[model samples]
Target: MDERIKEFFSWSDLFDYMVTRQLSHIRGNWELTWDHAAQEYEAEEDSYAELINRLVIELSELDPPLKYHDNEDRLAEYCKANLNWNIHKIGARWVGSDYASILEQGGFRDVNAGDLCLAACGRVKAALDRNQLHFDDMEEFHRKMLADVVAIILYHRSDQCITKLS
Candidate 1:
């Protein structure tokens, strides 16, 4: 295993690298939506999605030598970073809480939960692409789990749990 590849094997390390390199760009370019009641701004529709897409594309296009030498650490890092961004930033921003609370509501978790969950699905899809993990090859149970998670996020968003705060 190449030394570089050995370094990226830990998803946490990759996530840190990605955050250091990319978070500034994401924060700078993202459009802010106004929340009248909160008198604050948040990411606008599809902004998060676009950011994720760009990151995935850029990461995917990197020279294989830089991305990884042998192990799939690059792909795993991509997955974990995407998930962390959605769950920690986008989700928390929208939901005002975490998945546990949202789940206890007896319906959708909340707006944030929905946002994060949807983003998670997108990240998962990107991971599949990066790692060449085939959806077709996944067990039915795994597929269903992914679908359920995505559905919960969509449901939360659809339920209007994410209010304009006005």
Candidate 2:
């Protein structure tokens, strides 16, 4: 990875930032009024716990590890509030054949994980430009960041490539 990219990933709060941004979007879409959306997320916290715990465990296992809250309850609550809740599923699906077409066109089949992350970032940007996926609440920078994280997760999960991790 580029030094700058490595620095970006090394930020202790990068995961928090990404999840917070995602939660904001999810909240906005879940309710018409901001206050109501906020309330809804809070109300749903308890119900989201079981799922969040599973996700946290999964996240801990990823290469290029992320920093998570040390307190289990606090971590789970943060995850629920930020809606990092769905990242595991997102990563899993991305690693599957779901984005194969995009990966193929980007010539990413035999690349290293870092290269795959870069390709995924570009494909995500292209998709946004084509309006294939709407992320009305997120900015271009954020979308790319999220794509990079997902691509990293995909790289860890998939065995389609022979590139060894450095």
Candidate 3:
């Protein structure tokens, strides 16, 4: 963690920042390329994949650091107000997956759990509103969404790969 990483109250604030950043990226990119007329047949853009690309850029530059408030509940409320989608799902695929498969469907398959977690966080940015997401309990989409949320929460709470700028 950078000495400058702006400390937190609970895990909630950092998670909120990650969520907001991911969503902003998704919406900006989608608006640039969206074609409502051909939307049904077009390959759905992967917000997670987009987030990976963004992380790559941020990491290389060591630019913006994570920032959050001093309280958890207040931060959570801020997150809810700013969220593009009410909630996203998560599933096992987020923690583990084959590079070939992720590549086939579109994602940086050759990534670690941390990277995968970020990918999940990224999906939240482009997620459908909770009410709009209509997947059966056993549906694969539902499972993946669930995995994304879980991975994100785990990443936010766990201290791994945290580094400081030299």
Best by lDDT: 1
Candidate 3 residue lDDT tens string, 3-105? 1111111123233233324444433322222224632112224322233323333323332212111111222333334533142224312213332223222
Over the full model, what C-alpha lDDT does candidate 2 score relative to the true structure?
Answer: 0.33
lDDT of 3 at 163: 24
Deviation (Å) of 115 in candidate 2: 4.3
TM-score against native, each model = 0.26, 0.24, 0.20
Off by over 4 Å in 2: 16-101, 104-108, 113-153, 156-166
Best by TM-score: 1
lDDT of 1 at 45: 48
Q: For candidate 3, which ten residues in a row score worst on lDDT?
A: 2-11
- By lDDT, the better pick of 1 and 3 is 1
Error of 1 at 10 (Å): 27
Better of 2 and 3 by lDDT: 2
Residues 12-82, candidate 1: write the lDDT tens digits.
Answer: 31222322233334333333243345432333442332333233333333333322211222222333354
Output the better candidate (1/2) by TM-score. Answer: 1
Count of residue pairs whose backbone atoms collide, per candidate: 3, 0, 11
Higher TM-score: candidate 2 or 3?
Answer: 2
lDDT of 2 by residue, 1-166 (tens): 2222222222232333433333333332221111233221222321221222222233333333222111112322333345334222242233322233333233233334334443333433444445544333335664554544443434343333222223
